[model samples]
Target: MPARYCQDSPDAIASCVLEDMVLLYHRPSGQTHMAIAPVPEILATLDDGAALTAGELLGQLAQLYDLGEPEEALPLVEAHLAELAALGLVRIA
Candidate 1:
């Protein structure tokens, strides 16, 4: 399943995410929130653009997975990111 996640980077970044759908969330408080949705739903939100990175997706995945630090989240994110990339939901660059 496309997992829910949350992350707070030292510097806020904008990105997009998809599991079942596409969603968008910016680090308003340097914190990013995310959840799983459908690809079409996400595409609707992405009418503005295509392509999303881990930081762009919004839900509660990071927290859901217990990924705490960039050091920690990096690996976990890499795993999920690869999963998303495989599904064509995200691009690493």
Candidate 2:
């Protein structure tokens, strides 16, 4: 299954950065979520207002960070996308 997602606005979610860790607050839900490293980067990529497929997201992320094999990272990326969706930070498109 290919997962795709996008963010409407930065204001919809508030984020704080502490070194590699990022704290994300979902304003509508009034819930706070924590992310680190590639997680934050992944959100930022989607926050650009473009719905991206999991493969596209992985390709973009690979450019920024060294991700081994796409086959190896696909499952991991999908898992992260699921976590992001669970947080209400992203949605399936």
Candidate 3:
């Protein structure tokens, strides 16, 4: 889904930081999720109200974080997106 524009699901998700992890509450689904590091980073990036593809997100992440190699980070970004999407915290456009 790298080429697809992805955005956070507004109104359905709420988040708070808990130590090293972020606790996400999906109001609509009544589900709670715990995320660390890149998960919270991805959410914060999308929280800007901008829709971006996985590659674009990876670029933003690279600027804000030291994710070793860009090539390796792509899959990691995709994985985070998948997890967020599954939890109703992100949507593809």
Candidate 2 local lDDT, 5-89, one digit each (tens):
8775768888999877899999988998888877888888998888998899999999988999999998898888888888788
Better of 2 and 3 by TM-score: 2
Which parts of model 2 have CA positions greater than 4 angstroms off? none
* Candidate 3 total steric clashes: 0
Better of 2 and 3 by lDDT: 2
What tens-digit string does per-residue lDDT give for candidate 3 at 1-51?
355545545566788988898898878788899888888788788887788
Arrange candidates by TM-score, highest first: which order? 2, 3, 1
Q: For candidate 1, lDDT tens digit of each residue in 1-93?
A: 334332333223354655453344444544344545333333333334434444444233443344456665555554665654454444343
Query: Compared to the true structure, candidate 2 yields what TM-score?
Result: 0.90
Q: What's the TM-score of each model vs. the native? A: 0.31, 0.90, 0.86
Instruction: Provide the global lDDT of candidate 2 against the true structure.
Output: 0.86
Candidate 2 minimal-lDDT segment of 10 residues: 1-10
Cα deviation of 75, candidate 3, in Å: 0.8
Candidates in order have lDDT scores of: 0.43, 0.86, 0.80
